[model samples]
Target: VVDLEAIADQSYQFVEWTGDNGTIADTTANATTITMNGSYTIRAEFDITTYTLDISSTAVGNVIEPGEGSFEYDDGTMVNLEAVADEGYHFVEWTGDNGTIGDLTANETTVEMLNDYTITAEFEINTYSLTVDSTAGGNVIEPGEGTFEYDDGTMVNLEAAADEGYHFVEWTGDNGTIGDVTANETTVEMLNDYTITAEFEINTYTLDISSTEGGSVVAPGEGSFEYEHGTTVDLEAVADTGYHFVEWTGDNGTIGDVTANETTVEIFEDYTITAEIEEMAAEYYQLTVEVEGNGTVDIDPDQNEYEEGTEVTLTAIPDADWNFGEWTGDHKGEDAEINVTMDEDKNITAVFEEEPTDEYELTIAIEGNGTTEPGEGTHTYENGTAVTVEATPADGWQFSEWTGDVPEGQENETEITITMDMDKVVTANFEEEDTTLFDVGITNYDEEVVKGENVTIEYTVHNPTDKVVTEDIILIIDGERVVVQEDVTLEPGQEVTLEYQWEAEDAGEFTISTDDEDDPDPVTVTVEEEDDGMDMMLIGGIVAVIVIILALIGYMMMKGGEGSETEMEEETEEMEELETDEEEETDEEELDEEDETMEEGSDEEEMEEETEEEEMVDEDIEEEL
Candidate 1:
């Protein structure tokens, strides 16, 4: 018997079987087998019971009902499909290449997917708009002169009217509206975007003019004035014999020229003007100013003379190479110009002189190592003015003389006085002081010495000066001062040597110096550990003796001579060994002697140099004693 079972899952169902099968087998089964018969097998089949539902939009709109994705559903299950319009579009309908839809015109509908299905949601595009505007002085009505957005092939009504003093002329822009309306009202179709404007004309007005009793109106005939809108009208105020025009008032929106008595007015609306009048003032007299130099004079006034109470500004100008000196006559001030009122007839003079011939420039130049007060460079002074220049020397130097354009015969003095009538350069010469008095030098007893040995330091002091001296003499080792001799006098070219012994404790450079006006060059010595040559030679000799003894023993053992006892052979071997070792020792001793001899020779040369140096020191010490 064969067994068979029907398997049904959430997404699939077992439909049937094919090929080999048994009488008791089921057509649909999850696990089944047929009875064995001549190598045969049965095949089971499965059907997808749940199908996927895919939702999508044609434009940027969303699928509101079943969110965009594949959804699971059983066979013949119905899903509600819907689409929402985005900002600039409208949902049209639901469509597909496969699937059964309930409605074709509806945004919300039911879709039955007996098999796999795919569909699209159709949407329609929306419209946009352009705007229009008119400058000041008018108004627009209705669909008016503005932007309007509508669906394709939509009609919009437009109208235009103007403000109080303006009249509509014509409609302009966007191809002159739908109808060629020359009137203020019209209509347009918004097939595409559009911008438009309505033009208008301004109306005219009359301006009236008048003035105070002391003044009269000149331009515009002094009466009611007429002009088209935006036309310019000239206005003038004429003052009578004893009057002056002050200001204008009354409906004068803006004065064309505020500084003059006459001006023009623009008429956009009706207006009236009035001029204020002021009384006349007292009379003034003329004040004449004269100049006596090659220069110019400037005065501030509308006329040659100013009013009695007005203050006039006077300025004096001078040409190059000239300077303003003083203001003479009516004004007693030393200034070049002065302000005065025209109370009476006055005469004044402006005096100027040639600028003082370019002041004399005195320059001091330094030649050597010294500084000059009234320091280097130009110093300005009037003609015949006196300037004193002094030269000061720095340390280790002295001012010797002065030269170059200085006062006659004053070139040899440290300080010189000169009359600066012309530009002059003076040079100050300097010389170094005669400080070479004593020649002092110090040296170490040896160039190279071993640490822990005593090193003798010798200082040589020589009186290189021509004169004799009884002064304190001091010796310095490194930097520490040690007294040598006090109140000792010596003839010219006399020299003395002082000595000090110092222990060499550290291996390094050792220095010796002395204290004198002119200290001589110092000397340096080096200290270090000394090598022991004898110990090395002894070690070498011992090693050679051992090698020789070993070689003798090996030679005797390999000889194999006839009829020899062990004791005698051994004795002979000892003697031969001893001889070889003695010969080696003698050679080693000779090498050692040669090494010592070489070392002694070098030491002897060093001793000779030291002895010579010591003898020279002894002679100098005797002279000091």
Candidate 2:
């Protein structure tokens, strides 16, 4: 025998046995047994039953059922049942192929698969025929689907007119009904659709083993659904009368109440109970789900900002016939006391515990997946570092490339610097050789100053090219441009700081502008009154003169008039010299003040700049110091 216990439907076994008398005989013996599905064969016979039995035997049965997988649908395949015979007592009469209706022959019955096909012994069915019809259209219907609206509080009269001689019998439905019901008539009183069903009472039947009720068993009717397992799924049982239930006995004894039996089982154990007239199953709604995070949330409508740190509470309401479903995500839903994941970058979903819940498509990304509001931001990562990207445009501008010395492969939203070192300018039409500079800070000669002292303007210029800037840059101030005319060689990209001084003149407002508008702008400045320090000195000298005068008076009183006249002449000469020195100082202060307010307003502009070169130099200085 073949060991087929471990195999599924695609396997089988063949075995053989022999008899005594030293004569090799066929496999069939005086007593042999065969079984199929779960029952033993109804009849059996031996090949040779005379005198001494032969010993030789073969495992293959003379007449054997073919293996599965041969029969199919559409471009059809079939199983050929052959009864093998050696020298035998005449082969008996039997149907080889056509086992049921559409059967033609007694010895060889050929099977032609119609819409559906099944194999059965003609000995089983006597001569009965099954006729199916529906009160609504299409007697062959789906579960929990398809129906027509009828007046409420009235029984939906469904006429399942049986075959010619058959009479109406039992009725069934998905949601079992209750009311006055008999074999033919049914009364419905409640709501809910069902897999409405009805059987028939037939006579002159050849067989009772089977009926042509072989389509899909409708589950629920229009507006209805299947119930959860193990729960007492309530039904509007009082809707339709004469509504019965069809019980299915599975291979495994798992239905209602069964004793301990060690047997294997199939998919479902229970069966569908139905009502005669169905009122579609009803679904409940107003399903509410409440959720809360582990932080606080402040909703800013104008900015669309959600500030979360502690916890938040959210209430969700569903459409009619929907109820709050189990929650999915970091937290399980109960009373909404969910301890959210420390980093839940997505919104948790709450669903209805009903059939066919809706679905949505969401985008998932590891970086640059969120928005940074006007004032709010969230930091996320890619390759273990932070990055941010924006979908909206910045208020007054758009984002342009900042191309700086950044690490390679850095993508959008990575924080990097934009170079503002130099500006693009007109490249030709100059008296000197063509040149270029990199990250150079232009000079601004016009600045506010005080006229009482010499005013100094300092700027750093650079030749960032291989050529030299031979043009003497005339530093213009108040319309008086001063040309350096100094001959100098500036190496490639060489930088130099220049400082210029102007002597004091008449006091007046003067506009100090850059001599070259084609260059960068200049700085605006104020020149206040100069601090000459002469007032304090003059005051001190007057005090000294008073003291000297008093001292001379005292000396005259003590020594009479000796040398008094000589002292007076000396004092007069000293006073004259003091006056002359004071005049010169006053003139210098006045001239410096006048120089500051020169009143000439050339095209004045103020420029401010910060340089990376300055920073690099500072770094070098620190290293040196």
Candidate 3:
């Protein structure tokens, strides 16, 4: 068992034990006992002084902590209380109290409950509603529509935004102390509620233009009208009939290049724009040029129209085979280049007359001793002019042929006609005729004869025509007249030989020719030294004896008789003739063998002559030494 005792102080007293222990000796005792069957504590109970704490709030708030109605605590015990305001209110202050409190105005406070006390927490309203509105074209941006409540000294931001084609102007109605009154967005300290509106207006501007009397302004319609501010309008000026654009005038709003037909203008304010034009006038005169006579006219700076008093240089261009003639009609000069002034409409004719038919030089040339009737000189004639030219042979010459630009059929004619269309050279060729009465020729005494031998020189005359010709034929040998026939009449196609025999006394080269000038050409002959070893007289005598014997034998063979005995004699004669023939063949064989020795002897003589010449040269060398 345990025992407890109660002790009391001046301000506190021990309270009774309120526990479920084993047992209490006294039911309301300050001193108590508990049976300790296992373990127990005995609590002492005492009755001391205590108080009740009553906390209350004003109409819009409540005491939240420490219970709302009352709180019981022993004397000198501490109690903490809190007061909270309702939706639109705020806590003010604590009014009644019988204990010590921490603060009166604070939402939360502490007090010492020494006795039963009652305290009332006072609260006041601290909120204001904010109302926002705007004009029909715009609305508020922040803390936007409807009512809004805020605490005292709370900051509220208001912004107004305008719709398209409109702008914000100002704010109105129940507005608090605004931060920026002129700005679309502003702020306010909400000590009280606010209701505000944003005003807006539409944007616009003015445009004005005009045109002159001669032409009408096509673009912008020449009027004073309104346009949206800061807008770029296209401005143009179009010319009417017989007029053109000059420039634009007035207004500070400038267009690109005032004289241009199309331009632009920026409208910021009212402006008066004018498009000025000028009247049209003709500035150029007409000029016309014509050509004639197979030619063309070329003009410098050629055009259909030319400025008044302008001079155009005209040149006459002629075709091939033509020439520039005089210039007539509006230009009166023979010069190829002429100038015409364009004072009025000009009609000029470049008179290019046909040039005089081109004349070419026809040259007549004579060849081989001849002359021409047209003369041997270059002569000029018009184109296609017929010229007659005749060729005549001089003296013993006759016209043979023509050459060099002679017509085909007239080439052989002594007379011909030529056209002088172009430059030409003609040659009249001639040849000598056969007018010689007789053909006389002379031959040398011998082709090759030895000195001191008899040589016969022959002269031949021929008459090759159908008639008889009479002439004196003279033959010349070695430049001397050796034979002549005076008054020799040769019948047609007759040939006569007149010969002269003489002893060649010298060894030399000789020429033989006729005395006729037409047959002056000649032949040559050579005479050599005679061979002394030959016996001509003896050989001649032997040949004569042989010829006589052969003649007698031939006579015997020709005789004939009339009997059998005569036949026998004839047979015997035939036998004798055969014998004679055999003997002649033997003699001819002997002669041929002897002739070979003659050629051998001649060769030896030539070798001896060469040896003699060499010896002579050696002697000469010795004498010189």
Candidate 4:
């Protein structure tokens, strides 16, 4: 019999042992015995071990060349590895078993399978794209027009430039976020694949303004101005001394009002506008004519303004009972009509005087025991003049009528007028006075009066009989004497009116009258009360406060009830815990009592067993004997 063992070195494994002539047992085992007879041979064999290269990758990537999953190869074999990433993702490096890889930082590398090894291709989401552009009027200067590649979450600076006649407007984009959209130079955050553009716009046009020699542009004054398309601009021109503005002329614009000095223009493109002006044909002069008294001057042409060296006629036409006196200032004359040459601005005055007339005499005669106004003497007056003669009666007489050349409508009046066309005489006749007194009545009064406001009451006193009387005019309110006018006298056939102010003090209806026999019906005045808003507001505020206070009290009572219930529940839980603790104490006492009883019974059983053993020993000793 022979014993053979297969031994292996590092990175090597034992194979089946080869034998000839004799039977070999357990040929595949490393340590096995080979049974041999005479002329027998046995051999132990070993071979290089194979290894599994487990190739895998993280998310969004895979191994391409040596595909994913485990690949078997001999030990110390060189394997090719290549990692491919999907769209919007990049391979980072090889992860597991880094020491076996040739370049750990490269996506495509070689790995040596020295033993059973595992390798991983790591990838990450990183890169994105950006596209920038511009409009026709301008161009983007920074991060220029093109599609650009950048890492994810990158802040890119942007800038835009405009041409000479244009301007940069804003930055626009299809995706991603810009810091400032309206700014010419700004930044953008590249979160995903984005396309951005810088926009621009055309500039405004300039308007040139000027004026002619006689006038100057006042509004939107003579200058070069810039405005947007289809803008309306105001134009105004002021004329100088002795010159006037004619019309507005423009090179390229639509004028709203061409004939007016102040107008508007619509501008669509670059334009130049001018104000046209011209001088006047002739110099003007003013003819100012004034009259001293009761007359007016009339011009032949009757125009407000006159040319230089123009003749104007002055006719001083007098009013009734008046005559033209004289002309003063530039032309001085007493003629009724005159001519004046208007050389420059001239001021003239026309003075007029009364015409001469024949003199007449007015004699006032008294027929009774009364005095006439002229004392029964003759008076001289001009023709067509009116002379008033009044006849006042004595204490016991009254004026009846006027006779002898009195005015036609004033025969019954105590005061009469006599026209002095010729020599005239007037007589004031008087007679014995009657015994009747004067009649007094209320004429006009306010029917409605506000409280604390004054009301006017008008009363008239008339003497119908041919007598003069003096009495007090009394004003009464609500059947009581409130105001009195003392010493009011009424002549014969004469009437007088008086007024009184009475202030309303209370709010009610009151009667107003005068204390006279011929007084009219009493006037009832209603006094109104002023509105007092503050008292009503104060009462409403008190009621609102009471309501709010009651609501607060009700809410506090509800909260207090809820608190009592919670406190009762807490006290009940505490009582339950106390009862449970008492039950546990009773259970512990019962356990202690059972333990003491068992200990006492165990002692009695030990005593009984010892007595039985002693009796058995005595019986054994008897058998031995």
lDDT of each: 0.70, 0.36, 0.73, 0.76
- Tell me the spans in candidate 2 whose CA falls farther than 4 Å from its real position: 1-449, 464-466, 504-506, 536-540, 561-625
Candidate 1 lDDT trough over 10 residues, lowest sum:
616-625
> 257-317 in candidate 1: lDDT tens per residue?
6435688888888888787777777767777788888787787763677666577767889
Q: What lDDT would candidate 3 get against the real structure? A: 0.73
lDDT tens digits, residue span 333-398, model 2 = 644234432122334555543333233211212222222221132222222232222233333233
Superior by TM-score: candidate 1 or candidate 3: 3
**Root-mean-square deviation of candidate 4:** 42.9
lDDT of 4 by residue, 550-617 (tens): 54445445656555666546544544543354344335434533332244454355445434543443
TM-score of each: 0.26, 0.22, 0.28, 0.31
CA error at residue 28 for candidate 4, angstroms: 5.8
Which stretches of candidate 4 lie above 4 Å from their native place? 1-10, 18-22, 25-33, 39-43, 52-127, 131-202, 218-234, 251-259, 263-267, 279-625
- Against the true structure, whose TM-score is highest? 4
How displaced is residue 557 in candidate 1, in Å?
Answer: 71
Show the lowest summed lDDT stretch of 10 residues, model 2: 602-611
Q: Arrange candidates by lDDT, highest first: which order?
A: 4, 3, 1, 2
